[model samples]
Target: MGKMKRILYFRHDKIGDFVLAWPALAMLKRALPEASIEVFVTPVVASLAEACPYVDHIILDTGDDKAIRAQIAERNYDGIVMARSQVRTMFLVRGLGVPYVVAPKLHWYQYCYKHRVNIQMGEGEPVWRKGCRLTERLLRDNDIPIPSLPTQYWDLSAERPKWQAFYQKQADSQLVFVHAGTGGSSGSLPTSHFVSLIRQIHEQTEQPCQFVLTYSGEERKLAEEIHQALADTPVNVALAPPLDKLVDFAKSLVAADMFIAGSTGPLHLAGLHDVPTVGFYAARRSAVHVKWQTLSQAHKRLSFTPPPGRRDGRNMALVDVDLAASKVAAFLNQDQGK
Candidate 1:
């Protein structure tokens, strides 16, 4: 392999999918320090892509196939790693004469890739590791040594102070961000469940907490209702002020002592900072708690799932939020005790 200099890494997926690939992307950069890495991302996550420290460039895909092909051709990439490959993406780079192209064996386009790693076909492996496997193949084939990925990669130092100053006002309270909306892999908890969980946590907390209810789109009403339901409660609760950009919201997540949400993108963002996370997952194979688990450490994250049985994964109502809240409150108390 003659010193590959330019690489285009594809993670043109959803927000959470893109974030999970961060470590693998970082691994590629470490393995080839001189190569300029470019990531292909959806417009929804373009801002967050700019904040990635590992990659030198970002190519925002606007779903225009012609424009995408033009952009890919313009770069004259030395290699392309289809970390989150789609049928469209496979076709786009098909005959571009790129020196090296690698992807998981997904579509019949497996014939297109000179190197294909069998990933995403398995159930137990985490998504990040799947991406890393692709990077490993790229390294071994190119005679480069595979390197370890950092547990935490992005530098939030600059973004941290903004929340630090705001949090200073409530010096005695822990910052808990509870996102009411989710990018659906499964059904989310109902408003009543969230309210019950919040009330339970409030009742059992070892220390005071400032609950910041966060929501996107139509879930605003759900967040508001949770706030209204807790009006008479003694614990402090507030609505999270609207953030203009996804990057800004991501920055805010780093400051959280604890983050709570359904299996979603924001939880993965909190995972980036290693904030303690409490998440709800479905029991189905596709949305299993382990599959979508946060990037937070095992000890620092808590997960709940609906009971396992026929159709149980879609049964959000069967999830025992009260019990979950009790255990999670205990987890928080344990942390405070330490």
Candidate 2:
């Protein structure tokens, strides 16, 4: 009931997880309009939090518990909301001496097992809103009003100049963006698969459409391969740099006709921007890990798992890239006709 002057929001996940939590942050801002909302994120994803509209400060993960404790103690935060239930975070909050602390109730062992069982759990919410129930519950317990899911908006004027240039190059044709990497080290489609999918689309469409391939950090190799594969073809493929300037990457995705990608942040980005997306879900995780705005009826989400008899020791599974491509092409064709 009292005014919350300063609050800490701890989400030490990857890029996609942070993006998925944007709606929650937006809701929290609305609920506590006067509070200074700071986010604690890993170093790799700290930049994203800095670019979020609702976050006022960012604490980078340095893997130094003492330093983290010192930082939190010095800040004198009014409350701490641990969006992630990691043991490190729990220990950190306990040492901060905050008046209010909120976290998920699962035991450390169960939490670890859940993450091991499915990497998607490491991301955040699951499909049908089952995984994120804990997030909602945490907010409610802290008297934070739940923000509406599937938030949507568009701002063409705010787009980066490069995106505008890319748009102009296509002339009057529809543009489809294809992203093939996820936030994790693996779990992305192989270059050969991506090439096959793009080639199929190009042949079917008679080279009328443009394909933009995006990658981040080490995944640039995959983007390069896509470009090489489409070199002789009419499809245009290029690597998109991490748009550090944009407040929300989700906003950029709104300008696209359709988004096709492996399970990754861009897929979720498309969802937040309300772009129709077709995602290739790997067998290592459930489809629930894929975060999309609930309002997006245009999305086609698929998960590929090997047959029980073909199960290998490795958790990875091969997705049907051709099927995913067909769905993407069909979705785009429908949108264009409309």
Candidate 3:
């Protein structure tokens, strides 16, 4: 690691997990301003990765180990961090020319790393904080000063104002978003739950507001069902405009007065702009309620997690919809609506 000029941070994983690592990437780039920082990611999050201003290059993990290793070797990275550990990544980095390797000290196949960090999985600290701690450890051990995390890393300067302008025309019409998809992860409520929640928000909100419902390809029917149920309501329920790219949706979040979703990627995207967020996390997922908190202003975010040890707590259907809606409406009332 002598005079390190280049480094690689590997996080070829889920969308939410990858989005959370944005701050860690920012810390690394800020501390090592002169160094070339590269990231390894899967195609699903490639658009967001490319949107990141911290990293200089993006390495697509196309499941081709041989070609990936070749690319890694040529880059001559001084070190690599296994932010998201996998069996494929374990073998890929083993015996590679990279001088140092770092990874969370959890998995059975974790001994390969020279710098192993014990990231307490169930601890209440955010996953992104653990990821940043990994960067801090690597930098501090090598006597590098870790800079404080940035206010935000995803640059929405071009996209945010466009959406913001649209919301401004309606005389402080609060733009609230509800994303019903889990992105294939667990502990998500059904569309029926979202429909009920949306209705409550509409009837309960103190001011006039526009609501947007977001879903993926698989949840179209559910979105339709929710829309159909709310069609006759006083509040308008509109489907999120279809976007050509994931980055576009991420950018659009900056315009939101409030965003609601499960502990999923889109919720974290709302965090990028410090948008007020309401997240539904299930206890079965350890609802490390604090662990999965959105990256928004502390007072602005709210979370609902099923309590442990209770039979109903683990059931997504048993979540308290009324409580969530009441709190949401109360928050909506605080908005400076004309």
- In candidate 3, stretches whose alpha carbon ends up further than 4 angstroms from where it belongs are 155-158, 165-169, 183-186
TM-scores of all candidate predictions against the true structure: 0.94, 0.76, 0.92
lDDT of 3 by residue, 1-338 (tens): 47768889988888888888888988988899898888999999998888888888999999889999888888888878788887788887787767777888877888767789988765566778878878888898778888987665665666766886654425546788888876444477877888888888888877776888777777767777878888887877687777778887788888888999874788888998888899887675455557778788688888886656558665678778889999998988986452
A best-first ranking of the candidates according to their lDDT comes to 1, 3, 2
Q: Write the per-residue lDDT of candidate 1 for residues 208-250, one digit (tens) a residue.
A: 8778888777878989999999999886888888878888888
Screening candidate 2 with a backbone cut-off below 3 angstroms (N, C-alpha, C), the clashing residue pairs are 127-288
Of 1 and 3, the candidate ranking higher by lDDT? 1
Pairs of residues clashing in candidate 1: none
Model 3: lDDT equals 0.80
Q: Which digits, one per residue and each the tens of the lDDT, describe model 2 over residues 211-244?
A: 6776666667778877887788766666664665
Each prediction's whole-model lDDT (CA): 0.83, 0.61, 0.80
Using TM-score as the yardstick, the better of models 1 and 3 is 1
Clashing pairs in model 3? none
**Candidate 1 at residue 7, lDDT?**
92
In angstroms, how far off is 31's CA in candidate 2? 2.0
Q: Who wins the lDDT comparison?
A: 1
Per-residue error (Å), model 1, residue 53: 1.1
